[model samples]
Target chain A: MNIYQYDKSKEWFQRAVKVIPCGVYGHFSPAPYAPVEAYPFFSDKAEGARFWDVDGNEFIDYMCAYGPMVLGYHHPEVEAAFQKQISISDANTVASPRMVELAEFLCEMIPVADWAFFARNGADVTNMAVMVARAATGRDKIIAIKGGYHGTSPWMQAPGHHGTIADDHDHLFRIPWNDLEALDRILAEHGSQIAAFMASPFHHPIFEDNALPADGYWQQVVDKMHENGSVVIVDDVRAGFRLHMGGSNEHYGFKPDMIAFSKAIANGHALSALVGTDDLKVDAAKVFHTGSFWYCAGSFAAALACLNILKAEDGPARMRMLGEKLTGGLRDLASSHGYTMIVSGEPALPYLRLADDETLMLQQAWCGECTRRGAFFTSHHNWFLSTAHTEDDIEKTLQIADEAFKAVKKQFGS
Target chain B: MIDQLKSRLNLKAVLRNLEVLPALDPVSAELISDWNISLRFSVWRDTQVVLDFHDGRCVFHSDSKESTSVNLFFSSPAHLNNMFENQASPLPLKGFTKLGFLKKEFSQLIGRLEYFLKPAAETVQDEAFKKVNLALSLNTAVFAIPELMKLDPVSRRIAPQFSAGSLQFSVDPDGPHAHIIFDGQSRAVAFPGPAVNPTAMTVFKNSEVAQALVAGTLDSFAAVATADIQLRGMIPLIDHSNVILDRLPLYLQ
Candidate 1:
C-alpha cells in the first residue's frame, strides 16, 4: 500500500499558523500527533465516519471530531431537526419551546436528572456544576480524580499547565482514581470544606491505559461523599451517550447528583447540559450561569432528535458491538505480527497500546502508519466508535491496521 | 520561593554550563587550560556548588567543597542570584588571593557564556556559532527543570505526577543530547548526553529547528505539528517538562 502525502495540508497549516494560534489549538492541535508528517493538518470535508483532508487523503475517522460526531457526521435526523428549527428561529430575544422540550426530554431520559441547564460547550456546564455544588453546600473546596478531565477551566487544568497560577488550584485536591484509601482519607479530613467530588465515570487519562471503576468503587464513593455532605458530580461529557442512554452512571449501577453531558449530545451541534437532582435545582438557578448562545433553539432541537434516535436504536450497545469487533480484530492482527496490543476502558471508547514497547514508540509509529493508510488512529487518546461504523468499515480498518502493524514490525523488528 | 528557585537555577543550571563551555568555545578553554584550582560558591548554609578547573576542562561538583580552592560566600540565595545577574558582587571569604583569576579570567568566561546564551541577531548568522549557542541554551534549559521542580510551586506540584522514567531530549542524528530521569516521585536528576533506554524522547529534526526552539523563535506546538520535532514514548514526561521549559525565559532572561 502506498502512503499518503500532505503537501496541501502543509500549505494550509503554514497559512493557519500565521493567522491561528498553533494552526489548530486544543485537542485538535498536532502536539499529540507525533511523526506528524503521517497525519493531515487540515480537512476538506467530512461525512459519516470519514473525512477527506485538504491533501485529498480520505480517512476512516475514529475520533468523531473528538466525540461530537456520534450518530455520524451530517447525521440526517439531527441535521433535519437543526434545519427545521433554524428555518423558524434559532437565536432570538426569547427562549424557544424546543429548549423546554429538550430539558423535559432529558429529565425523563436520565435517571438522576430532575432539571436540565443548557450551555455552549462541555466546559461551560462543568464550570456551572462546580458553582451549583458550591452554592448548595457553601463549601470552598473540590476533590477530583488526578487525571480525569472535566474541561479546560483553570481550576480543572493540571497544576503546571501554562497560563495557570498555583493559586488557581488552591481549593482543588486530586486523588488517584479508585484509590479508596486516599478518597476515604480526604473525605474524612476535608470533607466539610469540599463542596463536590467530581470525576468521569471511568478513568480515561491520555497517554496511559484507560481504567474502569473497580467493582463497587463508584457506589462506595457516592455513599462516602453523601455521608460527608459533599455533592457527587459525574463529568460524563466524553462517555455520556456512548455508555448508556440515561447516563454512564446508570451503566455503572451508581448515580451522581449531577451529570454534565456534551460531545454526542447534539451530534456535532454546539450544545452542552448539566442535569441535576431536584435538591440542587434552586442552587443551580441561583448560581447565575449563562452563556450568550445558551438559549439557541437549533441545538436543542438537534439534541432532542439525536437522543430520540439513539435511545430507540440503542446507540451505545451498537457502538460497543462495533468497538468490540474492531478491537478484537486489531488485537489478533497485532498478535499475528508478534506484538501484544493492550485494549482498555469500555469497549465503546477503547484505548489501545502496544505492550511490546512500553515507550509507545512502536504504537505511535503504528498509529501514524494506519493514518497514512486511510484509517485515522491516534496513539494517545481513546478511540470513539459511532453508530455510522459498519462491519465493512471495521474490516477495512483491520486491514489497514494489519498493514500498520507490519510497517511497525518492518521498522522496529519483532 | 522565586529568589530561592532563581538562585538554585543560577548556580546549578547556569553556572553548571561552564563545565561544558570549554568544549564549545576555544578561547574560554584556553584561558582555563593552565589553571588548576577549584572555586566554591556558597549561600550561608543553604546550598553550595564547586567548580574545578584542570587540564583545559571545567567540571562541576555538588558534593565536596574541600581541597585547594577559593571560597566565595553570599549572605543569602538572593545575594548569589544578584551576583549572577551582575547586580551585586560575591564576598571573597578565601578567594582574595586568587582575585585576579576570578575578576578577569572567570569574568571573561562568563561573558562568553552570556554571549552565546543571549546572542546578537547578526552573530547567529554564522552556522557554526549558531550550533554552539543552541547547544549551550538547550543544556541550560534542560538542567534548569530539576531545579525549578524543587522550588517552584507549580513545578513542585507537577513533578510528583511524572511516572518513573527517563526522558531524552536531543537533536536528530548528531547534536547535543540530555536526559532527565524521574523516580516517579518529585525527584529528578538531569545529565548531559543520551540515556540508556529512555522511556520518552523528543528529537528535533535538525540543528536549525533546535536553534529556533532554544532561541524562542519557533512555536514548539507548531514545530511538533509540522514534524520538525518528533516525540515518542510516555508523552506526559515531555508534557510536564515543557511546562518547566516554558518558565526558563522568565528566569534566564
Candidate 2:
C-alpha cells in the first residue's frame, strides 16, 4: 500500500511533527527510520495483500508491519471481528472479560500454557516475565543469546549496545547464538547465580549460521537449567502459532517453563500474552504486571478470530506449504545466479541472506529497492507470508524476488 | 549537586560545575543573539547559568569570579543543535570533592533534582532525558540473558525463573564489540543490528539443545528435555539495562 502521498497521513504527519515528541510510539515507526521524503509514502488504508497511500498509490505489502499482519492488513475475518467488538463497545477498563476470554483461548491452543497474562505489546510481556522470574527465584540475574532481538526495553539493550548502558545497570549478560560448548561451560560455573535464560528458537531467518539446531539441543539445555535450579523462558512471540496449532514447542518436543507470544496471535490487534506451565505459573504470579489499555476488547476479539481461523480448515498447513514454495523458489533463484544465499527458519518466518559480511548494507539496499517496486517488506528482515498472500500472490512475490535477487547480485558482485 | 550535599553532610571540599541553559528562548537561530540564562532554566544553587550574548555556546555563571581566567571547555555548537533536535540534554552536572571527582554524589543530586522538578511539565522532558542518561551511565549495566530477554514484558512474565545468586555475567566493552561472560565462558558476541535497531539471538546449552536448534529443527529449543548447560550468576541489576543503552548517545553528544 502506498503511504507516501496520502493527504490525510501527510497532514497528520505534518501536524504531528509540530506537537508530538517523536510523532510515533517506540522505535518501529520512528522518524529517522521513516524519513518523509526519501522513504516510502505513509499508508492510508490496507486490505488483503494490498494497501493504499493518501497519494492513491497501491503496493503489495511484505513488511507486514515488521511481522504483525500475519493475516495481512484488514483481513476480512479479523477486521469483521474488530468491527463487531467496536459496535459492542470498546472496553478500556482495568481488566476486561475479553482479556480473560483471549487468555482462555490461548491456554487451549498452546500445550504448555496453563496460565496466560495479557499485554499490549511483546516488550510489556517480557518486562513482566523478568519481574516474575526475579520474584519467584528471588534472584536478579538473567541469561540470553547475543543478537536476539527481544524488544526495545532497557534490560534487553544492556547486553546489546556496548557503550549505551548506564553505569548502574551492568547485570545483563550477552552470549553467542547456537554455541553448546560455551553454554555448558558457563552455566556449570554460574548456574547457582542465574535467574533465568530467555531465548527465541528462530532469531531472524538463520538460526545459527543459516542452519537449525544439531540434535537434542532443547532437552539438554532444559535439563541443565533444571539441574542448576534456573528457569528457561522461551520467547516465541514471533514463532508461536505460526509453526503449529499448539505452538512451536510441540514441534521441538520440549517445553519451556514460560512462553511469550504476540504478533500473529492477535492478527494485527494490539494484544500479546505470556503463558506458563502450572509450576511456572506460580513464578509468573510473583511479579507486578500492569498496563492501562491492555484489556481492549477490539484486540481480544481479533485474537479470538485469529486463533479460530488458525485451527480451522488446515490453515497452518496451507500457510506452511505456501511459505515453503516461496522460499524454495527464492533459494533456486539465488543458486542459479551463482550467489550463495541462505534461507533459514520455518516457512512462516522464512528469511533469506546473501552469504557475505556486508549483508546488512546489501539487505538495506534491497529493502529500499523493494519499496520502489511496490512491496512494503524489507530484505533486511524476512518474508512473512500471510493467508492473504494467495497462489497468485506467491507467484508475484517470486517474480519480485527474482528481479530483486538479480539486482542484488549485480550490486554486491556475487 | 551531590558533592555539595556531601559537604552538607560534613564531607570534605566540594566543587560543582552546573551548566544551565536559558529558559525563555524558542531554541532557534533568531534567539541566539539575546539568549541569556539569568533565570528559569539557568538557576543552580547560588549560581545563575547564562549564555554569552555573542555566541550561543559561550556559557556564563554568576559564581564564576574568574570567568576570563577559568578555561572552561565549551560544548561544540553542533552538539547543542543535536540536543534540541535529538532530544538530548547536554547540560553538565559534575560535583567534585577535594579527593577527586565525586561523580556518584553528583548523580544522586541530579536524580533528586529531577524528581523535584518532574511536576513542571515543560521542564520535565529535558530533565527526564538528562537523568535517564546520567543514572544509566552511573549505576546500570546488565549482563544476563534472562534480563536481556526480559526486555520483552510479555515474555518476561512467562520466562523461566532463576535465582540471581545462580547466574553470573562478565561483560567487557573494551573493543569494537562487547564480550559477555556467562556459564563461566566468555565469547565475543557481535552487537545485534545497530545501536538502536532491534535484534535477537538464541544460544544452545548443549549438544542436544544445539541439535534441536540446528538444520530444520522446527521444535522449541527447550522442548525435548535433555541434559544441557546450566545458568548462573548475573551481575549488577536488571532494571538498569536502559541506563547502559541510553547513556551511550550521551557521551557521543
Candidate number achieving the greatest DockQ relative to the actual structure: 1
Chain B vs. true chain B: TM-score for each candidate? Answer: 0.94, 0.19
Question: What are the per-residue Cα lDDT tens digits for candidate 1 across A1-414?
Answer: 769999998888888998998788888888788677889978969999999999888999999988998998999989999999999999999999999999999999999999999998999999999999999999999999988899998999888788888899999999999998999898788877989999999999999999999999999999998988999999999999999999999999999999999999999999999999999999998988787889999999999999999999999999999999999999999999999999999888999999988888889999999999999999999999999999999999999998888788889998
Grade the docking of candidate 1.
Answer: medium
lDDT of 2 by residue, B83-193 (tens): 324344444433112112113332343343333323255654463344332322221222223232333332232232211222112111211111222221221111111
DockQ of each: 0.73, 0.02
Which TM-score does chain B of candidate 1 obtain? 0.94
Steric overlap count per candidate: 0, 136
Tell me the deviation in Å of residue B213 in model 2.
45
- Candidate achieving the largest lDDT: 1
